[model samples]
Target chain A: MNHKDKQIQSAVQRALGDKGLSRRDFLRLSGGGALLAGAATSGLLYPGTARAVSTNARIVIVGAGAAGLSCATRLNRELEGAQITLIDRREDHYYQPGLTLVATGVWNTAKTLDSNRRYVPSGVNWIHDMVAEYDPDNNRVITDDGRTVEYDYLMVTTGLQVNYDQVEGMSEELIGQRGVGCVYDKPELAERTWRAVDEFVDNGGVGLFTRPRGDIKCAGAPLKVTMLTESRMKERGTRDKAEMHYLPPGASLFSQPDADDFLSKNFPERGIQIHWDHPLTAIDPDAKTATFDTPLGDETLDYDFIHVVPPMSAPDSLRESELAAQEAPFKGWLEVDRHTLQHNRYANVFGAGDINGVPIGKTAASVKSQVPVAVENMIQAIQGRENSASYDGYTSCPLITELGKAILVEFDYDLKMKPSFPVISPYEEHWVPWVMKDRLLLAAYRAMLRGRI
Target chain B: MAFSFVGILAVVLEFFRGWFWLLIPLIVLDLVLLGLFFKRTSGRRRKFSLPFKASIGFGVFTFVMALITLPGITRSSWEMLAGAVDYLSLIGASVGFGVLFAILAFPVMLHMLGIGPKHKPESQATRQSPAPETETGAEAEPSTASQQPQG
Candidate 1:
């Protein structure tokens, strides 16, 4: 081609670029990419204006999980002369968000196990014991060892408990045996689940992935496990021999409406059966069966491999205490103003992480967003001021549809989509979202754990 | 996950256990091909050079495949070399994916939106070469006409 042809081609390219991507679209996409990239790489979008508030107040944060550690880190750094104590017996902090990756064979179990000592901050006191009782009335909490620790302000970041016994004939020991798998607990449990998943993938058979009724941490994990198992089967050329069933506890596969609709349509297309409103009530591992409490009646399904997600709730101690909500729906959950994250009746008490009674987002991402609110409000309380920071119930799920594609579904209290990337369509499966999940989100999660984001 | 140095190391090792190993050669070969093509094409350029275009097209494909293997590079980085290997790997893989988008994906996308070039316009391409930057449009038109008789 001569120079004239090159000129025409250049003109055509320019025209195409100019018309196809207008300045507005270009700027929006560029800006969104920059924000996500910034959040992913530098951990700069922390959304907090931290200033050390000098006080002699006693600050107690329960649990040493993501939320607890984050709050403790922020409080320890931003408060002066404050006696900050974090109470939790856990030494190894399990990165719960990565459990799905471990179970799906993408990540090793070691990837999930982290030492809590690394994140507990220097100035804060670490109480290696569980809070057996929360006595907000007396402004004190009793530890399992019978120590009554008083606090000027209490942060209940105890996370939640997995009720494996709620599913009849199921126990923690049953995982990795009899084709039973549960990814909600420890790193070992997720690794054990992988053993069952690996065998099922090799020897093609009935694979049942079930989610229980009510809230669960990292709600998208069950879906990811199912999809990744399917991906593995496809990769191994065993998809033809295996049958997969996803038993979500409700009519919708996910809480976000668009994501729910997408999953509803996408699941059947991939030959995975969706049993609507079929919450897993029990599983007899020895018999290789799962019983679901359908709206019509009890329905039993035979499975060679099953991923069990048990019903979750705030620990019994908190639920039985005054801190829990006494009303309907959010009963047994930490009763707090959803926006302020402060205890409804007690201003000194606050809730973070999975224990909070927020409508959605019991995720690491939620903890990242909520910790700022809870910390800011607690600081405000220390300053004898009204709560200023508010949590918007922000939750994000990188909903992986395949090994290489995902839809990043992010939303708030209203369930309206709030996409960080303007170019990546929230409704469609794309590699960028998958990259975000497989690579970048973990970095962001780590950053958030350190209170950097 | 932990995102600690050890956990990152495990993730990188975890990648090698899968098909990620195949992407290594695909990407190495792609870069080599791209490097040679660009070296030859740097002096003058046109819309189509079969070798350069094909290199870019396959380079895009290999680059995308390499990109999918990014979790390995992203998770773990060496501090000894001051992240030299880490950054180079990331930049190389990302650029490959970027080229695929710019050349192949954009054209198809633009065409779908009815903005991409469709006409061949043989007259424009086969006629005398475009005038230099110094020449005005008015002068170029008459020069083309006058040169037609001379040629």
Candidate 2:
């Protein structure tokens, strides 16, 4: 046997223990090589060094989120000799989507946070700094620490910035006080919302949840918080004492009609009050009064506890960039072709995740879909080939409608219902969707982000 | 019933050959289902006829394109599964196709059902009428105030 074969056999032997390998077992272990050869023969595997040949091209990826990491890893593998540098301010990469689950005491923040180094590929350089200025004209970006890096190719995955300031007389510090908790604001604060919810239940107080207008990451998250709180309150025998209210800026419970129908019908039965078209405007921590803009005019409601989902917008660096101005249609967001994910003006620039102006819910699952198209087009562009790869804007939202039941809304750019598995209604909360969200999605995110598919 | 039977046949074919031709029957079934959904939900003549047709057409076209390109896509995907590839091409393709279908399908589905932005009564009225010039004058103060931040 060859050296590589010997190594594989030894590894297999260790895994198999004292049991002698049957012919079937041996073939199964080495079947990967046979499949690869079959694929290569069929001209499926693109020929060339698995890495990019452009050694002189310096690629800079902004933000170390799922999209940024996925892009860098792909470029590092495909663009053989190209130098890649990933910039982000945070030392730890938190799976931001898990924050909603964390708010419900389902996941711990520590478990969601991973060392940024784990996601960064070996050959690529990692810069632990945020971008202060993006000058696409000069083909360079300046870091907050005053370091300027020039690049041949740039990929923006800075994601969205949470603006708690948008709410009148509200700041980050005021969160988790006087029953005012926001699960969407900071990853650290997600746990505090749960604490506030628990405290409110103990004190026999009403729990109020509010969703702000505009594009928010994981659009279903606010509802997830409300449902989980209700479920928890029922378990604690406080369902009668604590009235759960969901005040949303939108006219419906969910963007998807089927989901809205399911939630609207089911929640009322569970004694959860949903006030549609009510946007939270102000909060008084001292008096515990929450003010909302209703169609009936401004109404102030008393609440002992509140969970606020703050308004979100595109990152400031991207909003000010030339790419945003050039692509007028997507005004404040990164302007890339909806299909190929290539910048309309700059062929060398690309985007993925929340940074893109695509009219899809900003979630990690959305990033999961965009990452590959962005990588494919970038590789195609580098190799002087036609950028045939396109993105259809697939975004999945794992709406935890209750403690152990979730509704997985998987859709594309057109908002067509696409379930991962055959669902009875697809929009209704079920144990199957919940199990996948709670158990499978995290591993999938980690695997996909690392370019392991 | 015929569409469902064809969909089942397509599924059987897909199981044997792994070609996505199965989606053709499935998509046709979905269109029939959509037709039934509209007929039941709207209880009126279809108002979003163009968008509804476009959604079904787009779904079928995307599925066909996806299936034809499956071999090339699956090759890289299989490599990733075997720990030999790291590009996530297969996952990306699935997601990309899924997203495309969703974006096209949502509006049609919503409009047919008489919910969402398309069916909102006020929005329709606004589309029909040109506001008086005095309305622009009234809105000018807020626009100027918003512009000051940018300047």
Candidate 3:
């Protein structure tokens, strides 16, 4: 054989061998090869080696969540000799996307647990403290421990917090007990939720799933948990024994029109009742009753199992800060331009992730799309130039419909479907999207954290 | 149900369009490698097993493609056998891609081996001619052998 033919023959024989390489070694080799190719072509994996702009400005990022870590990695790579300080007391990084999966008993809690230290790039100042005050006028922030740090540029990415107090008598400790479950934040909480779901599915009962008022992270999460719980009961042949109800705070079930239509029709077909314009007000854990504030009056209902999704808002520090918007609609959130992602009043301040007061896009997919734009705009401002990047509000959600099927719903500010894979239709339930949610998204999320697309 | 070749072709095209940038270069390289392979096996065609070699090449290529795209399957055995639907879908997708790849690659492989498209006989004399039948049969033997299920 010729040289090229020999190489081809040898490679095929070696790959098909039974004992040449272990599974882990094979994965590392192949995954590394793909990442190397991506790095060479897109400069996303190893962006620091590419052309970096020189700057000495002190950049401070306020969170170590998905958006904050992504910003830190991108900024550290694109800017040289810049003092980047990441301020967040969180050492454990939770893969928030997988929380729903864990809550439904599909994934182990360990799969969603990771460390922030793995993604936080070296050469950046890591502060193990939370910001207590945001003083934009003085261009400085005071931490909870009374340490004042001044920055020439500020990137606010403090993700939203869930307020369990809004639902009276409901608390985190009540999860996994008394037929109460909530699939939000913290892998432990998700695991606890799974225990409740497991019990409810085996011994069928009246299950109440709720959605709160205003914007929330992963708006589809509550819906996913409800559907997955129903699916699990169906899988166990206990579906007929259970009565389910979905309570949305508003008339609409989803923000996107097509999805709302599909879900509005889908829920009833599956025998899961829908109660619109019902915002959850209180939950009496001892009495096993819940109250909803409706248009007519207060309505209370007894439940064998209840999912308590609380109203979410910006962190207390940022919401009460001077940098927050002081008007209607987007009040009490970080004041930022929808496109540029820069602070409206403070030129040096920028916001990303859930803290930004944009019309939509509060998911991890939005963080992936927003980090590059925000980093590019910050670099341009550092060079004393106009902002060159604009965020189009791209966000995606793999809406799991059943145990093994999902609809990959992707959209932008216009609420128009923008599917990444043409073969997978955005409107239909398919296994391809379920596979993406179950097996692919977590890796993609990690890549985003590393600023590797 | 009657099979629609055009529909399957469209499905394959839609599925692969995302990887066109990589597919184009790999296709060009395949043509080059086939050229070299054809030259090396021209005189020894009867001695070498073309079906075995082609199957090996295609199987390895499809497997590498799967590994590159779906890394989670190799993370652990739990990922592969987690749920019956998930396990079956992963295997089904890999096999489906292989079938589509074979459909796309067979024509190139045949052409590289000097087996062009079949032509209709011009007349009854030509149709009954032993010379034409022998020539066509000789060229088609390897193609038919390669198309057989290897597993």
TM values, all candidates: 0.71, 0.67, 0.74
Candidate 2 lDDT, B23-128, residue by residue in tens: 5556676677666656554523343545555666676677667645543443212211221122243345555785668554755564554322223255443444
From the highest lDDT down, the ranking of the candidates is 3, 1, 2
Query: Could you give the interface RMSD of each candidate, to one decimal?
Result: 13.1, 16.1, 12.0
Pairs with steric clashes in candidate 3:
none
DockQ of each: 0.05, 0.01, 0.04
Error of 1 at A111 (Å): 1.3
Ordered by TM-score, highest first, the candidates read: 3, 1, 2
Off by over 4 Å in 3: A1-47, B1-92, B95-151
lDDT of 1 by residue, A36-89 (tens): 666443333232335478999999999999999989878877888999999999
Model 2 lDDT at residue A19 = 71
**Residue-by-residue lDDT tens digits, candidate 3, A1-453:** 899999997786688575677657877889998976664445533335443799899999999999999999989988989999999999999999999999999999998999999889998899999999999999999999999999999999999988888888889899989999999989999999999999999999899999889888999999999999999997889999899999999998888899999999999999999999989999988888999999989999999899889988899999999999998788888999999999999999999999999989889988988888888999999999999899988888999888777888988899998877655678877666777788667766776787666
- The candidate 3 chain A region of ten consecutive residues with least summed lDDT is A42-51
* Tens-place lDDT digits, model 2, residues A128-224: 8999888888999999899999998899989888888888767777766667778874568887776777788777677778989877888888888
